[model samples]
Target: MAYVAAAAVLLGLLVVTNLILTVGVVRRLREHTAELAALRGGGSGGLDVDVAMPAGTPVGGFDATSVADLPVSLATLGERPLVGFFSPNCQPCKEKLPSFVEYAATRPQGRDAVLAVTIGTREETAALAELLGPVATVVVESDQGPVQRAFGVSGFPAFVLVEEGVVSASGFDLAPVVDRDAVALPAAG
Candidate 1:
C-alpha cells in the first residue's frame, strides 16, 4: 500500500511539472509573437536579435563600419532573393547549410532565391563551394569590412531574405515562410 501511494504522489508531481513547463513555453511564444509583430510594424530597419554584438565590439578583426562595407548589389547576385552572411568556419553554419540546401531544392522560392555568402579568401570560398556543392549560390566576401556592417551580421550563418530590395526576414526563425504556406515542405509519402 505504501509503494502504491508513493507512485501516485510521483505521478501527480510529474503532471504538475509538465503543466508548469507547458505554461512557460506558451507564455514565451506569445511574447515572441508580440515582439515580432511590433518589429514588423516598425518598418525597414529590420529585426535585431540581442545576440548581435554592440556597435563598437571588435569582430573578425574589424569594427562594425568596416564589417558593413562588403559590397553587395541585387543585380550581381541575380533577381532572386538573397540569403547572405555566413562563415566557412562556423559549426552551426555547417550543420544548418544542409537544411538550407534541402529547403532550397524543394521550394521554388528557396531554389530561385537563396544565396549563401561566406567571408573567406578565394581558396577558402572554393572549398566552401565544394562543401555546399551546387545546392546553393555561394559567394565570397574576401574583405568583411562594409558588407558585414551593412547587413548587421555579427555572427555566422545569418540569413536575410530580401525581396524587391526590402528585407523580409532575418535571424534563425524561418518559421514565417514555413508557416505561412509560402514554402511548402516535402509531401508525406
Candidate 2:
C-alpha cells in the first residue's frame, strides 16, 4: 500500500511539471507570433516579406566589371535598367533565372538594359554567368559585393527596376517589375 501511494505522488508531480513546461512553451510561441506580426508591418495582415530595398529608394553608387569585361556602374545603367541580384547557392535564384532571362531577352535596349549580379567566385559562378551572358551583362562578385551594397540587397533573387539611379520598383517577384513593360494589344482582325 505504501509503494502504491509513493508511485501515485511521483506520477502527479510528473504531470504537474509537464503542464508547467507546456504552458511555458505556449506562452513563448504566442510571444513569437506577436513579434512576427509586428515585423509584418504592424499587424497590417499582409504576409509579403520585405526582402529587398523598397521602391523610390535611391540606389547607392557602385562600379563593377562584367564577365564580358565591360564597365557597369550606376551612371552606365542608362535611362532605366532592370537589375537582378542572384546567388549561385540560392535555390530560388536558380528557379527564377529562366524567367529573368526570358524577360531580359524581350527588353527594348537589349542586354545593356539588364544587369545580372551573381554573388560567387569564378569557379562557382561560371555556369550561371555563362547562362546570363546572353541575356544580361553578368557581373560575378563576392558576398556583399559593391553592386549588392549599392542596391541595398538584403536577399537573393531580388529584382530592382532603377530609373535615373533611383529604384522605381523592387521586390522578390518578377511580375511587378515585368509588368512595367506589359501593354495590352488590340484584338487581331
Candidate 3:
C-alpha cells in the first residue's frame, strides 16, 4: 500500500511538471507571435505610407528624374491609386501575380487604378502582360532604374498605393482601402 502511494505521488509530480512546461511553451509562443505580428504591422493601427520607405535606404537602379519623365505618376493617374513593382524574370512575382489580380478586381475602380510595372525588355513585358491577362495596368520599362528610383523600390514586386498625387499606403497588402472613395469595379468576365 505504501509503494502504491509513493508511485501515485511520483506520477502526480510528473504530470504537474509537464503542465508547467506546457504553460511555459505556450507563453513563449504567444510572445513570439506578438513580436511577429508587430513586425508585420498587423496591429499597428491605421496604415502609414512611410512604412514602405525605410529612411536612408536608397532603392538601387532608380532615377527619380527619369521616372518623373514617365507618364506613370500620381498626377497622371488622376485621383486613383497605383500599386505595383515587378520584374518579369522574378518567379515570386509570377506566383503572386494571381493574388494581385484578384485583389485588383476587388478595388473600387477595378484594375485600371492598379499598375504593374515590369523591368524587362519589350518581349518580356509582353509575356508578363500576357501572363497577367486583363487584370492590371501593365507598364513595361526597358530600364526600371528610373521607376525604381522614383518609387524607392529596392526589390522585386514592391507595392505602393498612391492617393491624389501622394503616396497613401505601401506594403504587401493594399486591401484595406480598395473600396473607399474610388469607383469600385468587378473583375474581368
Q: Put down candidate 1 lDDT per residue, 79-188, tens digits, no spaces.
A: 33546465777666666667666665664554335556678875666666665545555556664545565556766666565444445455543444334324322321
Each model's TM-score, in the order given? 0.51, 0.77, 0.53
Highest lDDT against the true fold, candidate: 2
Candidate 2, residue 6: the lDDT equals 100
**What lDDT score belongs to each candidate, Candidate 1 first?**
0.54, 0.81, 0.58
Report the number of clashing residue pairs per model.
13, 0, 4
Worst 10 residues of 1 by lDDT: 59-68
Total clashes for model 2: 0
Q: How do these models rank on TM-score, best leading?
A: 2, 3, 1
lDDT of 3 by residue, 1-189 (tens): 999999999999999999999999999999887765553442344434342444233333222211223455444444555557667776656766676777766665665566677787667667777655476666667554566666676555566666544555555444443433233222221
How displaced is residue 116 in candidate 3, in Å? 1.1
Total clashes for model 1: 13
- For model 1, the stretches where C-alpha displacement exceeds 4 angstroms are 1-72, 76-80, 109-112, 143-146, 173-189
* Root-mean-square deviation of Cα positions for candidate 1 versus the true structure, in angstroms: 12.4
Q: Model 2 over residues 47-149: C-alpha lDDT tens digits?
A: 5555567887998888999888889897777768889988888877887889999989988778887899999898899989988999899999998889989
